[model samples]
Target chain A: MGRIYKKPVSMTKIAMRYCPGCGHSIAHRLIAEVIDELDIRERAVGIAPVGCSVFLDEYMDCDMIQVPHGRGCASATGMKRVRPDLIVFSYQGDGDLAAIGTAETIHAATRSENFTVIFINNAIYGMTGGQQAPTTMPGQKTTTNPYGREVKVHGYPIKVCEMLSALDGPIYLERVAVNNVPNVLKAKRAIKKAFQIQLDGLGFTLVEILSPCPTGWGVIPKKACEYVDEKMSKYYPLGVYKDLTKKK
Target chain B: MKNMEKYKMGEKVLMKGNEALAEGAVRAGCRFFAGYPITPQNEIPEYLSWRIFEVGGTFIQSESEIAAINMIFGVAACGVRGMTSSSGCGISLKQEGISYIASAELPFFYANIIRGGPGLGNIAPAQSDYFQATRGGGHGDYRVIVLAPNSVTEMGNFPKLAYDLADKYRNPCMVLADGLLGQMMEPMEFNFDWVDPDKLPPKDYIVTGCKGRPRRIINTLHMIPSILEKHNWHLYEKYQRIEENEVRFEGCNLEDAEIVIVAYGTSARISTEAVIKGRKKGIKVGLFRPITLWPFPKKAINELADRVKKLLVVEMNMGQMVEDVEIAVSGKSAIHFLGRPGGSLPTGDEVLDKVEEILSKPASPERERGK
Candidate 1:
């Protein structure tokens, strides 16, 4: 068979450790392509969160630091403060960023630390055996909440991008999905723009990507994308919440 | 007159302890001050903000203690001297950042004006943070250099000393003072020469990295257990070196003294007055003041163990320094404690009466005869 296309230079040659058909690899490749296109690979520092992607340090060619669970924002804050000349970004899973690291995320945004945050919302905790997360939809069943997530008991799913967009410190805030090829392309553009905002000295930019976790969501790889479109999109509603560069 | 003038360091200035500390930080070339206002130590950040701006420095009133500490972390990572000041509860909030700074081996100064605590206990002066400051407040096996300044003059000089010691050792150093010293006004001399931050030796370990050269990663991650253990061992060795070279103490008539008063900070100030009162009554009592609480002056007090019949440790808290005194005395002499908690400062008369009671005791002939 003839080769279909060349591998993106930004993507690592090594085999990925993520589950088969997982959206992480796609998201990772897209971010890598953006970094390659922008020519920021050398000066870019990636902060790996304490989740399934904790070993992101090994995959990326650039320098990376693994932050404690719920402390990716704090570590990125420290790094950006130390090296304001460099382009810094953090990649965090929903469980890590939305739950344990909620305080750090809010405070970092409030302080408007000049860094980009690539937040992945998979609705469920992937690494910890499909546990319920802060972004888990109402009435969603998980290992922790087997019966179902009752809003009265567990609270409604948090809309992080919408919440953070209200803060003046954040220069850009957008939510996108990886459920389809077209949406995946849009998410890549948002991610690149988020990093570009920091490069321009604009403060606190975040791009929330609605990703699919096939194994955690208890569905086949293709069906996982369908579930994200049918259920997750209804709740998350992907779009730009705040774009300071845009005019009315 | 010209020859005598050549021997002098600088002129004396009567300044409040907090103001003196701010001036000392500036003199030490500290250009970044980020802190939130708290009781007893408000003057520290207040003075530094205006003065630092006047000296072409940066001063920020961060939204919270967490922001203030992280700001310091950022500036320190740039290889510049940065500082933050807070009282008890505020210090508790800064512990996580302190741990990271310690593990990163970044040199910065933190002034913790201790107040009564276990939780928002009181804004009043207390040495309750002794265990937290000297024994590592955060979650880690790290030790920070703790300088306990007794008087306002020492408060002025301690910041400069703290900056030097932090850079020399590449570790966090704290100026641990209480509310009494933080609030008190006293005559201080800024005689020490300042070290310009811009002129200091370049730090190769800073996170700035080799711009066009090798890619350097600054992190505290050690996947290998043995490497982490080795790093911890090296830190312990540094602590040992600091203990030997940095331990400071002031001995007042310790030779042939019957009773020795062991104290530090404001408690030491009250102990000095008590020693004078005891001497006026013809009691052979002396004072042993610990200037540096950590890398504590154990050796000096141990040497005085044989000379003094009794050692009395007076403190604001209940018997915090008494343990150190006992460890120093090692059964050589009777170690006693006189402390007041909850913002109470023991007066000279109270300490003097205790000294008389200890001296007037009959029974042991040698102890009585020595008095």
Candidate 2:
């Protein structure tokens, strides 16, 4: 009998601290699998953000650094610039990436910094107790937006993929979701390609994963997945917004 | 190596203060620099923009001061000597990032060529950032090693000292200067030998890769209150060690002097001349310039307080370091302040005038301790 799927060698045996049914587990597993398949685990450097994914250093069995809130890309830029040989990526949440770190994200892309960013957009601030995020859906009710997000009051969701696609510095930009098995597979592919682009010395590749937050969304595990597929996917369309590898 | 070919060992070259420090950093094996432009310190990044590439080093004109400091934080994590620079308003923006660097105990160096400021004050030189620089300039209970250099030669040389102390303690070190020291042109030789970064020893704490060892995680987050408290204690111990072992200052004419002028950085330079002039006039004055501002030369000042009748603190601010001097003296010596805040630099004549006026007064009996 052939060997079936097993836990990735790139991941440590420590138990994850992510909330049950949170998409961080899936994204972590996918990233670990990608790192293992690419055989760059030894030379991989991960920058963990301050959101719920702050414990990314615990799960990923690679040399990692935890940066201040929302400065992941800036730190990643420093790491990758100094040690261009190492594979560097910043694991950031929606608030970490788009809200407080908006300047870092935009400037890193504009400079075409040679690193990968795994952006998990759960539409709400997870570690901070379900507060509104930059990607929070309009009419969505969060801890800060109990009456539901009004476009006039709370502002529209920041379409990161679309916004970054307008910049010429990025070599690849893709949006994927981990709501179902097929979508999970696509998300993994996009992540692997983003890393591969970085390995090729391509500049500033990012994959925005529309991850689910069952606890934050006040929904069961299944309903969170259903909400991502039914409602979240409509607001954040899934596809490649920019791919330099693809010619017109 | 290629970029530094022009600079000979022990050769005194005429250069601008900011540019000399930039070159000195490259000589000190600083292979990475990320800085944003601000007045008085812009020349550092501007010079390194071309100079760093000559030696195959990385230089980044960061999008903001916050980004620059965070980038250096990353480089330091990689076990490389990285640095950043800015003036007052910009350093204000960098406080949060500096806090993170200190909390993580990352070894990095930075410079603050301070301009006048309570807000975006002015581009002129000022020592107003004394409180901000010595008091951690950021959140949390942390202290960065602060070196106040008065001369352009010290500006060129202090980067090596900052790097040495930073690496020794795994703490951030700051070379605190002002616009006058940063922009003035002077001839000075670098104090340290040329350091090829590749020749430096590898750091165990650095996060290069887990090639043959367990993975390394450099982090500052301690979620549990007790654990965080323990981390703070650990940091406090390191700070105590630094205070014990690394306090540096310069004392001139202290023997038999009746009064002492306490100052650092630009004010120290001015007071040096004032002390010399006051001596020619038989005023019996001395200068005590603190080289390390945080682990401030408290012992020397306290002892001097026992001998001197008064301690006159000259600063380009509204009497900030005077409080520290008072704390060090503990009411043993009467204290007087001469301030020229908001970028108006005090001349030697002005400081000398203040020194004579304080000396002319009868010794205050209230602050006098029983001999």
Candidate 3:
């Protein structure tokens, strides 16, 4: 008999459509498990962004609003303000959360809006055929940056966690990876903690997860997971950039 | 909060169109207002800041028009009435959110106090946005209820009508006023019973708050091609129903008129004056004003073409609505157009001169037969 070890009650029976070894399914499962564990499924209002993950409503069993690209934070801020009783969070990818939506993410964090932001940084644009992303590492090749990213030309990678840490409003900021078993467990903890802080009526919270995109990275699934561990983590370190609770 | 009546019902007050429109939203129980400052429409959020606060609501002069519209989306999703306003440039920024709101079927109101523009044109009165409003302003095949208010009283009242229609259809409605109507001072009455948002039926579809309910999803994406196509067809059915039911227009002196002028908003106001002057000069000229510019009162225009020999369209832009008029009349009447773009407004006498010029041409047999 197959014994169930751990699962999420809020995840739907529908099959996931993510690519092979894509970390999005893992991130979604982690968030779903966290929401189920916290018993906030009934009150959770999720804002889905405009990328490959735009279909979060298909998997997440909670109330979900699929928003346009780069508008996740603003949409969540609006719903959270009117229905503060509900737990509102926006799930966004690197391009949606960083480049086009930079203003929304910054303003929402600076306002300390009482909500949660789950940012998935795969270092490349996966949905749009592996274009160079704002989070794409230097000396790396992408569709837009075929010659490997030059620092002077593309500018340095956007350290979103560090940039957000400088802002006064955000109460929690952490960066985690989901490359291996131990890291996957740690990523779950960070995601759960971000949601918990939102439940406690804390200020804005963000958890940057270094997701793997084997297709975008032009590698096999195993190589993609290994690349996230060896290469991605170096540029985006695994730690808490800011925690107001620790300060207090 | 102090115990005082914030507004006097049935009280006549001198107010600008933008101020009255803002207060009108307050009376409509629009509990949330988020907007960015743009020329010709700044008074809207400035008045709503205090007025919405007095009503125990929220007002945020957001960082950009981008943030402003999405903020409105946030509150609207939570089942409260939310709104935003701007002129040309700010409105262009709001189109993305408008497409989202329409696709989600979120009922809300937004006002565009029209200004001269292809891009950051100027803070002057113009109806250049007619095509944008009548046609869907953003991507996808969708339609929004567009109300063109001519007078300050209409400016004060159209927001309530817009919101009512918005809730009735679960669609977005816009009050398309211009800088001239928004900035000019006039006496307007404050009235209309404010409906409580709590009592509204959208609670059935609102995202979660009071626990243990089925999760509601407000979305626009239907990835499966057939399913998405079906969704578009459903939206189209609703739009067709709206077109049949919501066409509104005002006709002045249609009987025994040889020439008819078509216009709306400020141009209609000037055309009304022109019709009076044309009548005094024994020129058989009249005015046809389309209030709902999208549904367009096409039937009236089509029917009038059977009688009127000549038709002229006047606007603050360069020949936008003429296309719609051409479709309606179908060459049944000889058509003429006069417009002043780049923020130029044609006065009543100037429009009268155009009507006189049109009347100077003797009606050919084909023109008289409306061929």
Candidate 4:
């Protein structure tokens, strides 16, 4: 008999509670694989925010703290201060991170808090059944905007990675997508690098992954991935937003 | 009798209220101090920065009040004694962090040296933060143990007491003072035993979690509304326990008194002198000084109500603590309120006149005659 492939050690045997074909599971698996590869499972502390990834604490086989909605950055800041030895990371969705928690995230980065932030930007609020998010592209239709998002009324989408990269405190900032296998591989690398930056005691490092929300986008799972490639990628261009490693 | 160590309690010294509070925190085993400098309370952080460095402790000047408070939250989450001091406007910025600390059940200390106003209140001392401190300032339903210190000595001692109380109850505690107490220079003595954070029992419930034991979790999440209701009830029950166990008050010449004056913090100091003046003028008056404002000394006042005919509640704010006194007296005595707001401190003469006026009223003429 041939050897069987095993699931990532960082992933628990507990079944994920995410909806079928949701990209959150993929992102979770990628992060878990990185954790297992880096051998940081025992020392890793995950901060899970409210939204679809609220149960990221359960899925990831590591110690976790569930922060209040829009407070993941503050909670993670606290955790990082206490346990500077441990690798702390905050997993936040677009609405939770970019909208309500904007100040916390921006300031934490500006203060150069040594932690990793895994920002999953799906462009819409998924957990609350498809509401408009800060990163939702113009003309994108959400439950709250049945007439499509109006630029005059709602303002343009926030480019968090680009905006944060301009700040001096962040040691690493990158935006990656997880719609395809190639992008998935790149995202894993970016996630691993973000953790490694924290391990090096470097300042804040965030990897904003443009993920797909099949259920929230009102499209088939395959079409959701295609939609991210054709539509979302144009609005939020991929590639490294900032990297301090190559500076000196 | 000759060979003994004298108990050094209540010895006066010349020290700023903020400096005394910093000294008190250090003596109380506060190893972590993170704060941003704000008016009327900047001396606290400045003193801690110098003193904490001398004692081989962490002293971080955070980016802002928001960051400073969050840092304290982090240190407290690690089960270390941590504290932060700020004035009115800065404290407003810390509400979110305070709410998180409460939910996480982290015991920490905070010092609020109040200043004037509804906006960027003046740097001058005021008791405007009464509502924010006593009541829940944040969104959620929560309570913090608030200790109002009147003198520099009390300011120095309350930090230690606040730390002990916070640890014992597993809740955040506040040492509430105003500009007078924050900036004044007075004598203070440290008598409380030092707490060695290293020798303390291990905090298994801390976020550090069980390294070699079962996975431990500290959280305030209750998905079910029923569970949340139960949790809130449990918190209230703990508050009730605190109210029963930790009510502190000082009764000065309450026996055979014609009138009782209720006051706290700096106001209490003035009220004491006023009571003395009233006594010299043949008015039999006493002062009730509340040390712990939250777990108020209700039973003590209730007991004193039978002895006194009239009650006057004197405060720096516009009749805030008067409400508490009324609740305690329960209509047994006529409670007269005297207050000076907007950075103004009430003088001894002002309080004396208020007490005399309440005593000489036609309703209490018998009490006035006895005086």
Candidate 5:
């Protein structure tokens, strides 16, 4: 009998440096698997952001560039515009995507740049020792907000998929979680569909994976998965925000 | 010369400095341009908006100066000639990405049509960004080749030089001009034929795809302290070579000069006029203009300081490059400064008068400061 499971050829043999229970490794695997399944590993280029995923080049066995904080989409836009035949995607974390890179994120979508964005929204700043993030839930405790996030002072969490869905430029937008086996499979499918849309020469496509950061969240790996399903999923619902391919 | 015929575009055409420089970049194989609109340099993006499409290149009026510079960083990483342009505060915004590109060792090109500034200063011709441009202009210990173009013709021709040097060194190169040069109209001719970027030799480091080879990664993060230190040392050595081999300057009547005026960009143009007027009045004034700001023409200035009695460093700022001149002179000659900061331009008469006053004075020990 054939092997039941195997690593994707697009993934490097190097062990990821992510903390235990950090969803970055899984998210990276999903992207690598998607690239392999599409058979576009030879022409795929990834742009890594400045947060925890800055070392993304070590995990993805494809042409990749690590861009400055929040400038991944801008760099990816440059790569795509110059070489339209090549597949390009930018992998960014919550702070790297929603906070500092808000303008880059919004404008790239506004222009409908032909590229893919694999946004990992773990709702906290992982690399910087659990600092308050742009998507931090109200009352969520963090290193910066030692007394818990106050809505009046800290403001509301940004809903990236919902905010971006309002724009007409992007051809696809989806938010999926990686809490359970089924949800992980669904995330892989969404990631693959985003890449397929890019392959078909569609406009901007983004997949926001509600990842887990157990260490940042001050929880165990098992508890973090439960927290994602019970709390994070309720706030950031798991569904397609927009899909140009679907008819009204 | 036989080579001249290859690049000769026949007759000179009248063109604004910003538009001509934009055309020059396209002719020099810059296929990607991303810039934001700012005073004194807006024509650069405006021209390239339609012009880039004509050559089947990419033009993006990027969301911000940060995005624009990063876009060039992206294209340059792909081993393609790409550029961006902005002025003053806009350039301040681009420094973050510039540092990253320099650290990654990507060949990049850009231009700065400097306007008055500290914060949203008026859009007038100024060279206040001298220290910012020459001192790496960013957080890291990196250097960018800064070419100061004084005239419209030089503005039109310098992009080719900037791109060639950037590619040769795999570093950032910038054409540093001021609002005067960017807006002024002059008859200029192209120095080279339109280059086809496709014909350029393929670079092995570009990120096109892995295909049959091992994948390539372009990055600047060296988490390990020792590894990062080694990388910094590598950049330092490259800069050392650049300083040794790439120092460039243009001097006139230095053989028998009593006073030499050290200047660049708009100040250089004004000082050139002062030199001519001083010569007519038998003042024996010569002009020394630096073309490359970083890797500044220091050794030559040090040598020239020995022969001249006094060196007058003129600028459109509150004496920025004058500091470099002093370092190079190192007490060899009496130094004087004439500056007009904040949207002000020094007239030829004012500079000539300053030169005459310095010559008349009895070599004071302190060497007069800024006027």
Candidate 6:
């Protein structure tokens, strides 16, 4: 059959391993499509942290090193400093970045390491049986937070883009969503722009993408997208939190 | 603005053991160092701050021990020598990354200035982490090439040896020394020039932009169970080669000795004095020092097992290396252990007293030689 549009070459031939309609597949495709378009697949080096995204090695074609819990950003920092020729990036989740890896994320950004960070914030720990993540909604119930999350006990959800925007080191910081066709298009552009900033040899750049996690949310795939739009978006508003490139 | 530090090339220079380790890395073609400040190993990063940069390498004082090890992982994955160092507790924090490095089979050299521990233990010298160092500190079926250096000279010398052994097996190598060794100063000479990057072979697995080659993925996440098993076996086979080819030890007066002291690191240095004192007292005693602690000098110990009547194992820990000595002796000789953990060191006279006590005990006649 003549090809009208085929899968991105940056993604491997292996079948997708995420749950049906999970936003990970779409996000992975967005990144792969960006790498292919930029023509940097040969020089791209990605670090996969210990989470559901650990399976990224199976899909991402460029050089990769799967690190332990919460060390993706630190690993990418090391790779980028030593091999500035390679385009380095780290793909992380809410639990990996906001909680377990908070030190690495903040330090890497404060150091202004020239790499891209694609943070997928689904408001819950999708791997390891749906535990409460640092980004879990105030009233959201999870395995660890069996009862609906209470404000006094569970604390508030972390707005990563908002928190990181306070820092002066990062050159670009934006929050996007992949809840619908319009949002998906914005998310893809945000991901591509973050990578472009790195290609320009600028400082730290990150895109926080609010995506749907159907199995973790205990909802059908279609409803999960609506939930991301209606619920998650209310607390984690989508916008460009910081844009040093425009200021420059 | 050149700093006050200056030394003539190839001339003997007085250096601290930890600083010697840093200098050794520069001479060994190490290009990256990512470390956090710990008690005894603080000077390593301090020395490397200018040394690595002066040699046209990179140095990153990571936010924490966990971050430093992961940074080393990145440097190693990109195909160059990288290192991180800490004390016992900081090393405990680094176990997860160490496991990943071992599983991924990246080559690098790290130095551990053994300090007292169980928690945020004291800053004094202690070897209580022998099990953690030798038996694969991380969670996996893997062993690092462990080199236990006794003097500041060994500190200046072991980095090249450790890095070479690491690249030989594509495994992490550890330069195991105690806080005393790190604190002491000694004059030493280097075998090669310090700024020569062309000395060692270029990394074959380095992912330097992957020019005409297929994009490479240096990963350790094997989803399939059988695939992981195969990787483990591949590592095991490599370890076997290491065990066979790299067993190293130092023995003094073994042929005529009735009692042999088995030790390594700082304890071994003291034990050598004990051997000397015992020999002066007309007691038949000797020292068997293990230079390589992981693929332990078992072959030599097994051979010496036939000669010695009893082996007195001395250490600055609560008897960590005794277990390996026991394994090597294989019930061929009686093994006696004397240790002082928690930052206390057994003196040479104290070890001599223990040697005398063991020497006074009549040799059991029924002990079969080489059972």
TM-score each candidate.
Answer: 0.88, 0.98, 0.95, 0.91, 0.98, 0.95
What order do you get sorting by DockQ, best first? Answer: 2, 5, 6, 3, 4, 1
Poorest 10 consecutive residues by lDDT, candidate 5 chain A = A239-248
Candidate 3, residues A135-157, lDDT tens digits: the string is: 99999899999999999999998
- Which candidate, 4 or 5, would have the higher lDDT against the true structure? 5
- The 10 consecutive residues of candidate 2 chain A with the worst lDDT sum are A239-248
Off by over 4 Å in 4: A1-14, A246-248, B1-13, B59-64, B363-371
Q: For residue B214, what is the lDDT in candidate 6?
A: 70
User: For residues B163-245, could you state the per-residue lDDT of candidate 1 as single tens digits?
Assistant: 88989998999999998888899777876875556689888766453345444444566669999999899888988999999
C-alpha-based local distance difference test score of model 3 = 0.87
The predicted structure with the larger lDDT, 3 or 4, is 3
- For each candidate in turn, give its C-alpha RMSD to the true structure in angstroms: 4.9, 2.3, 2.8, 4.4, 2.4, 3.2
lDDT of 5 by residue, B1-371 (tens): 11212235645889999998998898888889999999999999999998887777889999899999988888988888999999989989999999999999989889999999879989999999999999999998999999999888889889989988888888999999999999999898886776778888788778998899999999999999999999999999999999998988999988899989999988989998999998998989999999999989989999998788688889998989998988898888888889999989999999999988888887654656657
Worst 10 residues of 4 chain A by lDDT: A74-83
What TM-score does candidate 1 reach?
Answer: 0.88
i-RMS of candidate 4: 2.9
Q: State how far residue B239 of model 6 sits from its true place (Å).
A: 1.1
Which ranges of candidate 5 are over 4 A from the true structure? B1-10
What's candidate 1's i-RMS value? Answer: 3.7
Q: What is the DockQ of each candidate?
A: 0.28, 0.89, 0.67, 0.36, 0.87, 0.74
- The candidates' interface RMSDs, in order, read 3.7, 0.7, 1.6, 2.9, 0.7, 1.3
Deviation of model 1 at B353, angstroms: 1.5
Question: How far does residue B211 in candidate 3 sit from its true spot (Å)?
Answer: 4.0
As for candidate 3, its clashing pairs are: A78-B74
Tens-place lDDT digits, model 3, residues B1-371 = 35324557677889999998988887777888888888899899999988888877888777788888898887778878899999988888999899888888888999999999988899999999988888879889888999999988888888888888888777889999999999999988866666555666655777874266766788888878999899889889989988999888999999989999999999999999999988998888889999998778888999999999799889888888888988898888888888888788999999998888778887543322110
Interface DockQ of candidate 3: 0.67
Error of 6 at A163 (Å): 1.1
Residue pairs with colliding backbones in model 6 are none
Off by over 4 Å in 3: A1-4, A246-248, B1-5, B364-371
